[model samples]
Target: MSNVKLKNSTTELRDLDALHHLHPFTDHKSLRSGGARVIVKGDGPYVWDSEGHRILDGMAGLWTTNVGYGRSELADAARDQMLELPFYNTFFRTTHPPVVALSQKLAGITPAHINQVFYGSSGSESNDTAIRLIRHYWTLKGEPKRRIIISRKNAYHGSTIAAGSMGGMGHVHKHSYPVYEGFRHIMDPCWFDEGQDGESLEAFGLRAARALEDEILAVGPENVAAFAGEPVQGAGGVKIAPPSYWKEIQRIVDTYGILLLADEVITGFGRLGTWFASDYYGIKPNIITFAKAVTSGYLPLSGILVDDRIVAALMDHDDDFNHGYTFSGHPVACAVALKNIEIMERENLVARVADYGAPALAKLLARFEDHPLVGEVRSVGMMGAIELVADKRTRRRFDNPGRVGLICRDHFFREGFIMRAVFDTMVCAPPLIWGDGEFAEAERVIGRALDLTLADVAGEIAA
Candidate 1:
């Protein structure tokens, strides 16, 4: 590690954090006892902790830092914008150059039908906006009863009350008491865990798609406004659907005439080797929620791509939409996003992921397929997952979900790598900048972690 200096020692920092910082998605009691790892610096795909241990970032800073870290260009963009505009709101009939330029660029890259944008600071806020827009659009069309939005079980939309309600994760819902009404969930098309024995993948995919139709019928099609889903369930352990899934979903939604909302917060901006996953999957959504990679995690910015039809409805309404954020069209965030897109385009990161990064990562992940703890390994574009199981042949998960995955995750962190654990699945979404050297290092670290985790649970494995 390079010579680094800090005013306070690591222990002091941890003490201060433990005293004041309450982290998200954390067990506070456990964190207070064990303390938190202090991340001090980041460059490219590596981050250095307070103790100066350089760790490979396998999850791309929560799957947002697509262009990697420490990009002087993004810094320059933010600095330049701060020096000029600093901050401004897009509300009250006001407009700004940064947001306008970013919106135009986004329109050029998103699905052809999506020409308008609604700005927010995070995916959660934007998803909330999507729900309002969906219901409001139907209300404007004189169908006030069309309010229910169907999402898939285990899919994660966001953390806000409304967004969290849209998400189908039971754990999240347990916290959101009386989850905001108007959202229903169906089974996710996760073939590995949910597929029945003797069911072909194609058949399972169709069945999963049919789940949406069934839900719509059960809820009464007249009361359903839209269906929301991630292209490949990112937070749900990188759950990639079978080839037949999306096409069948599109047909079902079309037959019902309900809107489709593609939550591309994780899959947008070249993560899936396309500007938007909707384009890659060939699913025409009325709205596409995006964030994360747009600014490449350099700044907080997220929004939704509104189909022209929705825009037309708003235009015809001639009144307030009654929703927005203080950080909507934040000039600094928009400026950084503009520069981020420029860098991505100049480097052809999207094409690189499609042609090389995806294939390379797939090959790297496939190396773990024969490992004793691995039941399945899957990847698409820059993301991948390894299912850690007790019985590989039977695909039997460990007794307690997330227990073994946490064990393996800690091993990876201690081994100077970062991989997220979702239940018993270890998932990774590396920086788009990774190449041969990063892959080689990832292979070594991942293999070592798996071996350590296997030894920890060796007795649990079926002979």
Candidate 2:
């Protein structure tokens, strides 16, 4: 354990990455100047960077890693499947056993009326499928004009052209070409920032939900096919939805005969103390997109779990749906995901999160609830955020997003907690399997970083 040599031999990550890797969502020029945080190994919720620093994965490796890291069972499952049947395509009316078994398990666990699974490799692509399938569902129903898909401001779906446009992240879409056509946006049901002086949280939730109704009516109900949302907005600052919000959204979509597409990429696979976020929210979506935790981030795997009725419509039409990926239900990915789900069940991780999570994490957050820079501390299940605002009284954001957030995140990174600032909020979604001690340590570390960073910023402002 004495210094595992700063990086692997032959090529230091800095030197190799400089010449070879073009990192995603990063400016290559800036990356070349600053270098990378190369992760070397992981075991049970803790990872070591190339520097040999033990880093707690506060963001759960992009909000996946549900069963935690270094599970030998997942590796064994992948190895077994790779040897048995390495490759197959579901495109040519051909299917494989692992794929079949996974679909059955997914359907069985999913709430009633959702009976089919369409596979992809990530949430972005799966949501891209939802975009295609939902719009086409209208065409099959003889309402071809209904192509608009409504989303919310600050909502994050994914980075694909269609999915990123579906999101309202200014950072993602600003320099890029215009957002995808027909992906309409409305305000988020974020009560803390958007609620007025006298408005109740319930009233604000309804008001925000009503924006969808207003937009749909303005565009004409015939022109709108579906409304897409995360059950609880993740990545967009972990915004919690009020109880009235989802029910009202369901009511609105039902009233207009529009489809409800729940993007469960982060909230799926027991992240929310349930199999699907939709179940926790108490609303049924016609289509749902999932990824990240499916294989516990072991292998890239994602899928759209469709309502049986949507599948029924496609069955009645042409025999072929004319959509799929080359790696659609790829055997190895399926094997790994099946193993991940099995681990979740055998250990009862879902129920554990529901029962023990709040008390386990709340004490830590309560300590920072009164921190001056903290505008809010909100969490449900294992996912949470502590938002930093220039003025908590007004919920006013700092003039610069990346500057303040990046400064705060750098502090956390130095403290050996790998957390990120999404917009102005510091996000923390640790592996659900983390023990109480690790959980407490994570909050303590993050809290320390916040105090140091907030004071530095305040001093600068005063100067």
Candidate 3:
């Protein structure tokens, strides 16, 4: 794809893509010029392109394939449930078995205090529910002015109007559409990029975390309701916040009596070494939005786990809580989610991620620690990022981020790997099921790509 002019011999996929494909975050014309490489199927850690080339899913299907691809068990559970009950809208006080059972299982596994759950069909929808619920909850308590929800700059939440606004990804915001009112963007604890020289990581973390306090105070604490953030910033180039950041953030939110909403859409399940990134970071959020691995993405399922305090407030005051989706608690989706959790638990997959994921991934990272073109190798559990820079000393990005990253991405794709180029940062949140060998293979492939990228993008990187 360096100068994508490839031809599609069989026009089946390309024709469909050209006719009906309105891709998100893509240059449609460029994609049209480059015939679409339709990923027809996947098995375990690999997927086959339309041309039958096997590519290792380094990004794990946009960081969602926690249990890995071709897990027949998930398929089987979905199939069985679909046959029994395909679709039943969770409306008009109708209840279902899977929804009830799954909620119970989730509550049992998650921290005891964070027990109440609200269901939605997607991460975006779940976050939407969270924002509304958070605001409405505050309103119910007569604190109507506590409406502002704080989010970090460069954060990626979701694409819905509310969720996108809650997220701080600049490109995600639509000026014409204008973000909905009451969502404030704040600086992140991105140590590598923003930390000043001679500052200790811990010191930098505390300073960064205090920004939330500044925001709350600036906005007036009485007007701030919640602070929404990802445990490990996923799409904003896998920006790992400093160690003390979450603790400080929790302290600030607690001081202001504000809610902490953890958007663990990517870092939840087994991706973050623990069952949830909030648990891993020791930040007990008031509300946590989850998706992706809820059912290993087998069926569209997402949720928000609410803290006991919020639940108690709503229960004692509100008549019925006043909000829910038609598919709030779909039985089959919930059933599959329960099964996915069971599979993860029965195999100790979360423990495995903590024990083996980082160590195995460390080897790959070690190779880049001293590489000339590499700026940083940051990792937490299976979640990691390899940032490329022109001047490592100055932290200068390549002149043409799109071109340079695309070169690396193209080479890797052609050489049998699938990893996303987040600007010039290559991100990886592979499935927890990956073993030592898979890690090594990914490293080798990536190393080869880097070598070629450095050689190929010499002019672009230099410019």
Candidate 4:
């Protein structure tokens, strides 16, 4: 660790935090009462808190940090780029070498049809760009009325007004000041929760996919602009789509001749054991929203991969697109992204996650299947989720959903592991760099936390 100013104690830092910091998605009253766990530093798949606890990060820093923490190579890349060209805009016909190279690199790895990228600073910004791009594309194609975009309930695209509107989460929408118009949502293809009694997983998935078709027809196919979805719903509890879902969605989009937008913010890079989850699912989307893992959370960089068709359409229009961010295609961020991809390629991190990390995690999590409190254990690539239920046979949830999940999440923290609780489902997306030993450690810690939570919840239920 570098020489830095030291605080008198963790309590001092917590006091400072409580005084000023308004954390995202946090309750001020709760934070003021309990204080916050201040993370001091990080290395590999672990982070040290202000109290000096070496906690294993099972959620991979909000589903980013796929390459893990404290990689000097990435830091060096940023430093070199900053020294050479710290900042430059991709607006007003200005161009930079780093952005140029990064664009080419992204094109090379993304789907064949996607050869163009529009950069932004975060996933929310990228989805906003996507909305404008899609709506403009339709306008250029002489379909100005085709503005409706369909999303799935519980899907999380981003938190911006435009992006959050694109997402289907009711909580975000409820609080969203002046929610944007022209968005419709259908049922999510989460078989574990929504599947009917005795309904096969494949059948349930197909039925869910049909919801998109139903919505499109209701809105009228000619009036719909595009359909947006995450390849795997990350914030929606790591909900993996059943085998038949993506294929049917692909058919629906193609049949309507409307655009298909894949929100790859969380599932992009190696999180899905492929360059992008669309490739894993064999679905060809017209636009792909990417962020988070592209730079492995080392730097803020997000973009939308526009299919060649859209690029061609824009070219034919010969009208100014007139949409961008101040830090679009930023040189230093682009340079760090290049270095991040290089490291992934050199280390074969994608292959490692596929052949080593994912299988190990799946095997370890599968043991919880027969546990009394566990209703289901599902995983894909390095991400997994364990759903907690009051009655396993009935898939009945606790009296108050998310209360038990919060309890389990607390246990994970106390036990030196970090897993996020989405309602009653405990989800994890550990770093791709984690190997057998890390997986084993995570399994052991998580198992112990679950046992403790089961007992705690049992007493609560009895009471």
How good is model 2 by TM-score?
0.96
lDDT of 2: 0.87
Per-residue accuracy of model 3 over 1-463 as CA lDDT, tens digit each: 3323244444765876688879877778888888778777888888887677888888878778888888888888888888988778767777778888988888886776888789988889989999998998898888999999999998988999899999998777964288888999888888878889899999999998998899898989999999999999899988998888889998998888899999989988978788888888888898888988988877888899999989988888737766777778887888788888888988899999888887778667778876767888888888888888887787788886656777788888988988778888888888888886788789789889999999976764443
lDDT of 4: 0.91
lDDT at 361, model 2: 65
Encode model 2's per-residue lDDT on 1-463: one tens digit a residue: 2453543542465777788878888878988888888788999989997767999888889999999889999999999999999889888679999999999999988989899999999998998999999988888888999999999888888898889988878787885587778888899888877888999888988999999999999999999999999988888888898888999999999999999999999999888899998999899999999999999999999999999778877988965677888999999999999999999999999988888874576666767887878888888888888888888777777887767888899999999898878867887787889788787788789778888888878953321
> What's model 3's TM-score?
0.95
Question: Residue 61 lDDT in model 1?
Answer: 98
- Which runs in model 1 stand beyond 4 Å of their true positions? 1-5
Best of the candidates, TM-score: 1
C-alpha RMSD of each candidate structure in angstroms = 1.9, 2.5, 3.6, 1.7
The superposed Cα distance between candidate 3 and the true structure at residue 277, in angstroms, equals 0.8
lDDT of 1 at 131: 95
User: Of the candidates numbered 2 and 3, which has the greater lDDT value?
Assistant: 2
Highest lDDT model number:
1
| Clashing residue pairs for model 3 | none
- TM-score of every candidate relative to the true structure: 0.98, 0.96, 0.95, 0.98
Candidate 2: worst-modelled 10 consecutive residues by lDDT: 1-10
Task: Please report how far candidate 1 places residue 181 from its true position, in Å.
Answer: 1.3
| Alpha carbon lDDT of each predicted model | 0.94, 0.87, 0.85, 0.91
Model 3 segments more than 4 A misplaced: 1-10, 460-463
